[model samples]
Target chain A: MQDFLTIDALSKYYANGFEALKSINLRVKESEILALLGPNGAGKTTLISTICGISKFTSGKITLAGHDIIKNYRAARKMIGMVPQELSLESFETVMNTLRFSRGLFGKAPNDSYLEELLEQLSLLDKRNSQILELSGGMKRRLSIAKALSHEPQLLFLDEPTAGVDVELRKDMWLLVRHLRNEGVTVILTTHYIEEAEEIADRVGIIDKGQLLLVEEKESLMQRLGQKQLTIELQNRLEELPTKLSDYDIVLAADRQSLNYTYNMRSGRTGINQILSSLTQSGIIIKDLQTKQSSLEDIFMSLVNETAK
Target chain B: MNYYGIKAIYKFEIARFFRTLFQSFVSPVIATSLYFVVFGAAIGSRIQEVDGVSYGSFIVPGLIMLTVITQSISNGSFGIFFPKFIGTIYELLSAPVNFFEIVLGYVGAAATKSLFIGLVILGTSTLFVEFNVIYPGLMILFLILTCVSFALLGFILGIWAKNFEQLQLVPLLIVTPMVFLGGSFYSISMLSPFWQTVSLFNPVVYLISGFRWCFFGISDVSITTSLLAVFSFMTLCLAIIAWIFKSGWQLRT
Candidate 1:
């Protein structure tokens, strides 16, 4: 896929000399879902703002669909849509009017059918005529999505789209994001919810303290950094871990009923069979065994922790 | 040119104005009627004439100018300020439209609104005073120039203001007083020489003088000077707006 959006060595420094964004480089491929995962004040919003032309970057270049964001901003901005984190809306305006206003502001011809379809997809058709103030928090979030997509932008930036949303709505939002991706709309979403990125992101970018720590394929990152744990449930209670298991990264459960063995996924030999054989030889009767793969959240925490050091 | 973008913003602002019809349109008309009652009927009964025009009629142009100037600033400032206050300005900043289109939309809507109110006030004033517009074309020209220029100033104020108090500060403290003391109810000639010279320093004087000339062919300053003042004020506003857009001052961080 072609690189639809590129950020080359972008840096932003405030007048007071606080660096909001480091010299960052990133390229978003067309029709891909890129999730930016970061903690509070991690420059996720700053990066998105700079890319969307809301903030003036101190240095470097950004281009959208081959147009320089600074020099040809109109052309670049025309192809992009952003749903901000705050649910800021014209409280008196109806949902339909909001969509119409956004579409028109993006220089797109009014297309009622397209907007209606968007509302329907987001389950907001029933509330089209309802004023924004009358809508619930979840409904407002949906409206924000509808508004952002009203112009049919080739690239969409969802800045914490599911923040404060209920679990059901968050799931629906994930589904909508996937649907948008299937329609060939590239998506860049910043999220504190690791599960959101784990569920829908094609690629994940972890940023901390105004610096991007890494950007890699989600699956590859999981494979490279993910750890697997094997649990040996013992039928008989063990008072202590036999010295034989100490070398294998195994720990005895506090209740003395199970043994846990940790192993790196990338290693060729997990030593699972050896550990099981050792357990059997040590007269620890195994009732059953189970394994668990570390979730993206675990990987994310470790990565952020590494940077904090 | 992004005509659609400008139109969208303009229509959005106009719709908001209509939504608050009583506050935006009717309130000013009511206020103008009260002004006519106090200044035109009560006060005019004592001072029968000023500069050969009936006292009631003479204050007509100044009244319209006052409403137009203040309304233009209020509407223009609130139009942009509300969006910023509510955090919806992100859409405007991120939209494909440029600064020119933005000004055209916001300032255009604000001017149109003040123009409507100004014209309505003119009609309402006629109920209280006998009036005639000698140069109807020039009257409209001055009306529009005032609306556009002041609306532009309001846009600057809206961007520069950090809070609601700051937003209302200039229009309330500076603009309203300037309009009242700019010879809105009386000609500068009514004042002594020292005060007359002081009134000349007020920029609103040129606007009122120009607009009054449109009604009765009488003005404290030459028509050319008034026009020059209007243009200069407008140019200054446009220059500030241009700088705001260029430097991303207040509007962008």
Candidate 2:
């Protein structure tokens, strides 16, 4: 109950009998940033929407800062700030008024200084007087965050805050999320970008087909599911690995100019030296070589596949 | 009640209304004026009087009712519909505001726009033909109730409509024709007995007759019946809206 947010036995069944969420239970630690990663239509949005009270649940309860979402809906809602996945803004409204209006919607009194600081933090001070329609797409996304932060909710939900954003804006958003977490605001964001979760999430929750596959600390999830790969590019393309090189398990590049060897990092014998020596003995010329560490994407795929099986 | 939330939405709607002044205010006023020109002057010149009231003055209340009812619905429907259309309703729905406050913000702003446009049309009508309100208080009351009720209807239509064609279907083909046949241009008493009886069933008749009664002390239906009719219709609209919110019908998925 003392945790920032909690969902217990939550289920949502639409009128058409499509089950969007099934008996989901989870807890969000205070002042931490948790990212929910999933492919499209995997109930990521449904989960956030249900928790935010945008969509009603058929059964179960949600509590925000100990306020029951159903019985004390207003109080529960007041503790949450959500930036919806949709790029829906009042295009005619200026950035300043949009923040003011959003703050007012949350039943908060006017505080221009706090709003100005939020805008400054989001790098939107210059566009404060500009209508949202006049701003760039990236700027609009930033404004959405500024609007959500106006009421200073204890828990913030950024639903794909940088889904279509450019690299620069995404970096800027990552910094903002870190700053918010440092300020004691717990953030729960849903992202299709695995790299985003890896970049900012203290804890990552992978969901697929309306099921939460796993929730774990970022470092542990990566260590347990991660694999490393070694790639060698030959100076010349070959149809297949030569006979002497065949003993080393390898994957040929689609273009037939490269080979990749993958192995568990925790294993004592990687056998990489044997493979390299064998390639040299087989008279295959290696023009370049690179190694890649497994990212959250691999873990996510394996987790999704494991659950599907 | 979320007073500030209501004000936020209300102000936003008002700003949107003002932003598109030519479309929202001027166009309706011009259209109402054209109705005055065509029906009041052009046609009235041919027929001097209808039921002892000057022909030009007789159509005044009906024309206002016609515009007010349509304006309320259009403004109300579009006010909420555009958000749903553009997917902005998600943000509003996610806000801390309750369903009643959301409705109040949208429908209230819509009703205000209808009232504004209705008054503008009334002012425009004065330039064509002079008229009087025998019961000024009742005229305002009916005006408010009609605007609010029809606005609620439009909000429902906005929610239920899946496309633009469906949105205009009721107001254009159904409601507009009902208003014209409901005695906007001519008195129901001027019609034959069979046709007049059918006109009684058109709900707009009571609204127009009640509104017109306040103007010329003459009406097709009693003022009490007209008031009751509009009140009950408003109550029905409210009930439907309540049900929509409770069931999370189209709003939640």
Candidate 3:
């Protein structure tokens, strides 16, 4: 399928030979939310910066809405809006002027009605005339989004949009992002919040150490790589796993009250039955059992660690 | 450059400058007035005339040009510096505006500000000492040249500046000293012949001499020399700024 935004073989190397991004390729479909998950210095911001033409890429090609990022930067940039992490707004300008100016920056015709709607949507209507420095942190964050949306861009990039905001404001931002996607605006969000990706992303891409590790639909990624852990309460505190149970790959708890086994969901054999039979053969009885499905956070951690290796 | 995009950024910067109109418009006047009082009046009372004009009246053109040079640099540099430091430059770089539009918008607004401030100081100096602009056309020409020259200089300073301390380095250490030693308060003729020869090395001297020539109809340096220096300096600065914008020197890296 054709993508609304396509990044091919993107790479960046600073003057001092620091490689920021390495051969990252991504395709974002129209009107979908793609959560880019990564640890610090994982090249998330660098990718966004390159795509927006703010930072020069060492080598790569990016196309936005069918326009080349370098050859047709103006048209490509006109279709995309970005909200940076920092709330670096003009301290003295009114909120309305900020949005109006941002819209004009895109060469868009003045549409006070649209500006008004954006202000209202961001809950900034009452503060439209207020100075940016006077607004609260959350208000400033909202204003950044309002400014980005003011241009009526088809593609929106949020670089850690809710990194340090309060929980309530984060929820508001999430709903607002969802609303934007519903309106047919594709959102490419970079975030450290794994749960936020789980809650809102239609697709997730894990990037680590300047390389893209994986990109897949959220549910499909979970189903393909998710693991289930089985914990069995033991009848006795065994000093070690019995020889018969050793082949089951079961781990004994420190207090000897539990045995743990982990298996991939996609694998046909869960190993729970085999482990139970091995335990029975070793004359062990389980008193209680519980299971835990691998969470998005767990998958993210393991993926990042594996990539590091 | 997109015309509308340049207009928008220009308006945004102008609005920001005027948001505290009392501070932006009034502070320069007050500072200039203090200089006029202390240096133009008190100091001029002791020193004799330079050429045929009173020492106080002699410095008016230089002082006015001084204000234009310093303020244009500060306004242009800080207007962009703070944004870059606080990370809002990312927002601008990501916008649809091209680099030319960005430079034009910023440098244009900064020039406008210096022009406004120059006129204000010119009007204020009238109350202290009476002096006629011998060549109004030339005076306006020099005013714009000085503004654009310093504005481009400031544009370079803005990109080169990395922090608040770096922002203050040029205006305070380099520019202010140049304005002082460039003969803002005294004529280079007052110095020894060798010193007079050395004063010709200071770029600000030509800026001041050219501006003062427009008012008093005479200059310490030849009018042709001053005009040539101003034009050459402006051209050099413009070339450097255009290169910086083209290469995305400090802005992109």
lDDT of 1 by residue, B1-253 (tens): 9988999999999999889998898888999899899988998888968778999899999999999999999988998999999999999999988888999999999999999999999999989999889999999999999999999999999999999999989998999999999989999988999999999999999999999999999999999999999999999999999999889998889
Candidate 1 docks at the CAPRI level of high
Local distance difference test, per candidate? 0.91, 0.87, 0.85
The candidates' DockQ values read: 0.88, 0.55, 0.68
What would the TM-score be for candidate 2 when compared with the true structure? 0.88
Error of 1 at B32 (Å): 1.2
Candidate 2 segments exceeding 4 Å error = A15-17, A229-309
Q: Model 2's CAPRI class? A: medium
Per-residue CA lDDT of model 2 for A97-150, tens digit only, reads 888888888888889999999888888898889988999888888888888889
Give per-residue CA lDDT, model 3, range A1-309, as digits (tens).
568998899888988999999998889999999999888888898888788878898898899888998889889998988888767787877889888888888888888899999989888899988989999989998899998888899999998988888889989999999999999999999998777887899999988779898998988775655578889998788788878776765788778889888777666677777778877888888898999986655766787787679
TM-score of each: 0.91, 0.88, 0.88
Better of 1 and 2 by lDDT: 1
Error of 1 at B188 (Å): 0.5
CAPRI level of candidate 3? medium
Worst 10 residues of 1 chain B by lDDT: B43-52
Worst 10 residues of 2 chain B by lDDT: B90-99
- Alpha-carbon interface RMSD for all candidates, in angstroms: 0.6, 1.2, 1.3
